[model samples]
Target chain A: MAAPPHFTGSLGYPPSSPSPRSHLHCLSPCNRAIKVSMSQNQSYWTCVTQKIEDQLKQLIPVRPPLLVYEPMHHLVFTARRTMAPALCVATCELVGGQQPISPNQALVVASALHLVQAALFTHEQLPLTDRPIPSNPETLTHHHAFAAGVELLTGDGILSFVYELLGRSDDPAGGNSERLLRVIIEIARAMGSEGMVDGQYRKMLCSVLGSEELCDVGWVDHVCEKKEGRLYACGAACGAILGGGSEEEIEKLRNYGLYVGKIHGLMLYYHNNRTGGEEKGFTDLVERCTSLALKELEGFNQGMVQTLSSLVRASFWDKC
Target chain B: MAAPPHFTGSLGYPPSSPSPRSHLHCLSPCNRAIKVSMSQNQSYWTCVTQKIEDQLKQLIPVRPPLLVYEPMHHLVFTARRTMAPALCVATCELVGGQQPISPNQALVVASALHLVQAALFTHEQLPLTDRPIPSNPETLTHHHAFAAGVELLTGDGILSFVYELLGRSDDPAGGNSERLLRVIIEIARAMGSEGMVDGQYRKMLCSVLGSEELCDVGWVDHVCEKKEGRLYACGAACGAILGGGSEEEIEKLRNYGLYVGKIHGLMLYYHNNRTGGEEKGFTDLVERCTSLALKELEGFNQGMVQTLSSLVRASFWDKC
Candidate 1:
């Protein structure tokens, strides 16, 4: 549908004085301006908006409707185009260089990205396995969804860039393409159950809720190994894949991943250690984990080292 | 004083049934076992305990004194130590590491870390630059104090680590140190006036209270630059100081800072959009600024990246 021209700034007169009763006429400036613009463009409108407005007027009868029903439809329509420019740009981007995608198609892609990002983030923020479990599923779910969405957007953006590279015929089997694929897979796996999300949930539940007698250390370790640990492995695998890394390089990347995971875990533990007594141990733990992670990253091949280092350099841990 | 010997194994008692009547007396077997152990340990206690117990007893009297304070003090002292081993460890660590560290050092550190972490997380969770200026000075003071404390701890930790590097002859050149100093000063400046805090306060007074016209676009830009943009810069600066990075490397880091700052701002905007419509945007603008400041560490290094990434990974943004 064609959009109406914006008439917001075409005021008929200057603003009136602040005193009440100074300008009963001033209140209708917008309507008057709109009427004047409409009159000037009447012939053009008759050929276009006149029919549409007539149809709309007919559809929306003069009779009073259910108050609830009226607002609901109006709200939905208003919300659908609330951020018109951004959504329009997003839609165009989604449909670019490919088949035209429906609005729903774009929305689905957006939603999937959201979910993936949420899961990754939720897992990362969870405390160490030694702590208590979180009480609320909603909070967990909310975090998971948010992280997943962000990851999806980031991955999608990267993927789009990859597609562009492919389109440009830039080294069909180049290391960059492989690295991009690996990043995608790494992100996907991390979004999976055998990654950060599950590990964090398990740790939180065990520490917060599990009875001391009932809790099993092995179970907690298993969760970390399978979930959190595996995500690190996946990330390293991706790095190796992308960089065309040797076995030694791969191993170094893997070690880096493990170090990062441990640091991540320790940070969570540090956060959870709000009781004054636990601060020293947690801080020490954070230091050890960070140092270990740095050392491991340092051991990687120059390219892999550079990549990992850059990523870390772009993060907050180095600051502290 | 030495810890009392701990009893182990069976107490030579039948399994007691859950009965309210005998609950208090159910420890008879345990008491008897303790007595037996005490008799066995009499020799071990004679030399050590005689001196210690004499001192302890001397602090008390054979009969109750008029004050009745010594016994209560001793009881509390003994009980607190016995009940909380973690507390003891913290106290020892704090005292041992002391260069005139406070008596409640552990509490201070723990509380400060938690508050800062929460502030950071909350800021990230909400939309950017959307926090309203605090209506009262008290709230402002509280936020400032918390932020200052966090900055102190984080900066101190980084400086101490750098000092260690210096001790090991791994220090960067004087030029690098000078750059670090400049970065720190810049961060302080950004956090002070011409920063997010001021921008937010101005926004609050203008919007919520209707004290002025909509904030000047320049003011908004300045606020964003300081609140969101500069925080990432601070994080990057800290990272560069820690990791041996050139000026060019630090410049590259600015992209990450910018990306995170924008995202942080957007997130806060989104949150405020959902919660309070346009008016809340003013409040959220301020809040977002503060949040950015808090999250400086989160975007600065790998460990923090992992922590924040994990959190976002778990959230609802994925669904959106």
Candidate 2:
């Protein structure tokens, strides 16, 4: 039996070939036709290929075939592929030594770990930025911390460690380690003085701590300037570290981080403003942050930046 | 403040002291009076002490000032002081990982692996001694393949591999490999040609593929001989493996395994005991498997073995 001919032009059948049986027959030509067409219409085939290639240009390119033959690339790819599996095998051996765990227990632990990662990733993109740095200091700190948390949670060191542990513990009992680590982290984050609740507390504290009568205005400004600016920088640092970003990538991340942070802060401030707190300066700060997050978010293509924006929105409870 | 005077006799209270503040004080006084009376009457206190001391002469005496150093007599006492904290830590970690897990996705791929283990363990306990080994050599080959399959599925090697993977992937993505491995194994066990369904198919094939005249005699013996024996052994192996039993523990596990296998095989036979052309032994095999599972399960201490037994029961229909 002969192979079918390759379609040379548009995939669409010619309008004149309307019969169903004819269309099927046309679509599945002989192998001889396929071979003949390949040899005879090389240029035409190349043009068609180029057009399709153009459509898919944005997608990550397959590594060059020659690269697969290169020791460095081959080694790296193989290493990367095996790292998680190897780790998992080791973990299982360890667990097997300690005690056997039921398969069900293993499943539960694995699923739980995945959920934690998803949650942490979702939380990373909270604080939004706007026009870049050189903005109000207060907004910067909030953004930076949020980004830092994400980096700590998802960095290669941590992610790889987790993969290694899961891979090693073929026994469900082995999942206990991963489960414990996640729980401890979540509990620490939730309960820490600087965590979500504490963050809220700090915002309220800033109002009183920065007041003219109770605080030295210069001291308050100095603290905000130092802390807030550092936070903004931290946000960029976190993005670069976790996303395997370059310096330029870090700068872009920083901009996005700051924008998201400001927006998040502003949303909080705006919501708080509506509820009885009447500080005009705080209101202005809130407005500035919101504008910045939106503007920065708009700079990137919607599809490319959707994860970042969605993360930002989720951080501010916009999705809630 | 000066240390309270050491109590004398049994009461350890001054005679002139007002009645003790509580019921304990009253008992002390009575005890002391009795001790004094005995001492004076027949020097009975000394005699009683001697006897008591003699009875416990081989045991180390508790040092009066160091209650903390005393060895705990009860298992619960030791457990409370030692294992409780460890168990608490383990449970806390496990629950914490599970907190982020949505209820819907809680049943993960790892669970399927566990089900396979449980089923295999239950099937390994069949009472092979009760039935005669098939005289026809071909029947023996089928039995051996069935046993090998059980062994492969429930073996330590596979369990260890799973544990290793779970240990490595503490992060969200860590669980994927484990889940994938489990899903593959379960799909193989439940749906593959050599799996549970296939086991039934082979049994039926044995009856029809051979001479029609000898079908009833050969099929009856085959079904009866193969009755849930393997399942019992499988279940026992599952429990022992998970329980951290060593090679030395195999005899006990084998005992339990045979019991469970017999019950499981019987259940499978009963379920597919239909007649004529539609007599594909699937239903009967399933029924026999279940019966054997329940029977072998009964040999175990229900309280201690509940975890594995419940898993085996659930796996039959839990859909992994």
Candidate 3:
């Protein structure tokens, strides 16, 4: 239960093991790997994150109305991490950079992807149920309505902006209209009903209807696959797709993303929550997915592959 | 205060005048025109609505975990009207239909737009503030969380599907990658911060901070133009863009859409809530926008232009 010896503040995990309700820590092996990886790839992650942030800053226009943009600013700048965008840039570079659109253009698309994700995060935080009116209901009402309107619509705004980014074809990498359109469609599919949204819906039902009766591995895995796995997979696939990876290469990166997400989901949320899966089963899934992801990087740039492989492997080094 | 003479159930307006707090009824002149227009174009409106509905029925996939899709089904099937999609189709037809993508393709995009709008509508209904728990708080909590999750994500699901349709390039009209991308981008711009989302944000601020002083014509008009006008304009513009209308033609259709939306916004919400604008001022704005919309159709197919002009005119025949 004690914290990993090397785990530090920058990792953002708790000092000790994740508590029953806590859902943001990795295993010690994975935890330690992140610490080392963070130090090693400090510049890489920082640069990737910064690039996305900078591009979004420029791309998201500044109109007279500040209300709409403020929440968006908070959401983008203050997110937990730029993992999706990072994965995108890393994958784009790995795919040999053969596409007409540059990695920078991929990041622009990634920024829009992050915007959609940020919108989801914002909406998720809204009070699900109605609360009792406080003594000062007026202030509460105004704040709630205002914040809700801003956050909800901000997501929609960013979503529209995603298409705008592609439409304008402002890619410094020049124009790859066909490829850009393909990437847009792929991201959409991954996020649509059968993908991330489906995952969220399944997760909800499992919690409500399934309860203790069905808190089994299958349910957890299903929820994780749809919710987290799909988005990450989509992000990785998008990077490869936009980078002009071959179909085989795109599939590999997508699998890598799915596995990375799955591993994260298991470590992050299902550790204390699991009811049926053995520790070995969990570790096995992680091993399987990790290997699968690494396999996808075969034949890509050696440095890029190593970075991505390390990124994926570092998360599961505990049991490995 | 009485319902317009020709007005009936199909208009979807109230039989009597809107209450002080109510904001759904159109002005009597506009209302009467709609009734007469409804009778005149009963077939047109019905056909347009049915086309969108039928296409949507096919486009929105049905899968397992019925819970996730249920809300989407309800939202799409039970919308107030198919006006947005109707505009997209109408404009597509009006633009001479020379583009490779079919009218059906435009509908596919319009359906996506409607999905985003539906998502906005669904989210808007969620309580911004958490309400006091009722007697059975557990049931309330579960229901609230479940409903919130479903509604919030359903919007996202539909938004994603919109891109999928376009990405698949299933445009039976053939292929026009450049134009399609352009249309996609234009739609994004219309829905983003400077467009619908900004309008919604401004409207919220007005309600909260500008309740008294800022509740004038300018405020209402600004909100209407952004929230309502921009969307219709986007829809019409998409139709023209996809239909291969010239830049001038596309611009004209877009303007026409903006004007239609402006008139609707005036009659729909401001009739009972305005403070600065007189009835005369309201009439003038309607006249201006309507004339502008009609003028845009100067060289289009006579029949299509007349249909659109009539559609725009039907809302303002109060003076007639």
Q: Which candidate comes out best when scored by DockQ?
A: 3
lDDT of 2 by residue, B165-233 (tens): 222333455343333333223223222222332333334445435555545534543443332333233
What is candidate 3's local distance difference test score? Answer: 0.63
User: On a 0 to 100 scale, what is the lDDT of residue A300 in model 2?
Assistant: 40
Q: How many backbone clashes does candidate 2 have?
A: 122
Q: Relative to the true interface, what fraction of contacts does candidate 3 keep? A: 0.77
Docking quality (DockQ) of candidate 3: 0.41
Ten residues in sequence with the least summed lDDT for candidate 3 chain B: B18-27
The alpha-carbon deviation from the true structure for residue A130 of candidate 2, after best TM-score superposition, in angstroms, is 64
TM-score of each: 0.25, 0.22, 0.78
Better of 1 and 2 by DockQ: 2
Ranking by lDDT: 3, 1, 2
Q: How well is each residue in B1-320 modelled by candidate 3, as lDDT tens digits?
A: 22122221333232242221211121223334555434434445555656677778886645555776667777665544426667887777666664434565777777766766766655555555533232222223333233666777787787777777777764423546677787778777887878877877776676556455686666777887886688789889988887778889889889888888877776555334543535555666666776787777787766455556655655432211
TM-score of model 2 (CA atoms): 0.22
Candidate 3 chain A has its poorest 10 consecutive residues by lDDT at: A18-27
Task: Give candidate 1's TM-score.
Answer: 0.25
Candidate 2 residue-wise lDDT at A39: 24
* Per-candidate local distance difference test: 0.32, 0.30, 0.63
TM-score of chain A of 3: 0.74
**lDDT by residue for model 3 over A165-210, one digit each (tens)?**
7667644236466777887887788778888778766665664564
Docking class of 3: acceptable
Q: Alpha carbon lDDT of residue B53, candidate 3?
A: 71
| Alpha carbon deviation, residue A162, candidate 3 (Å) | 2.5
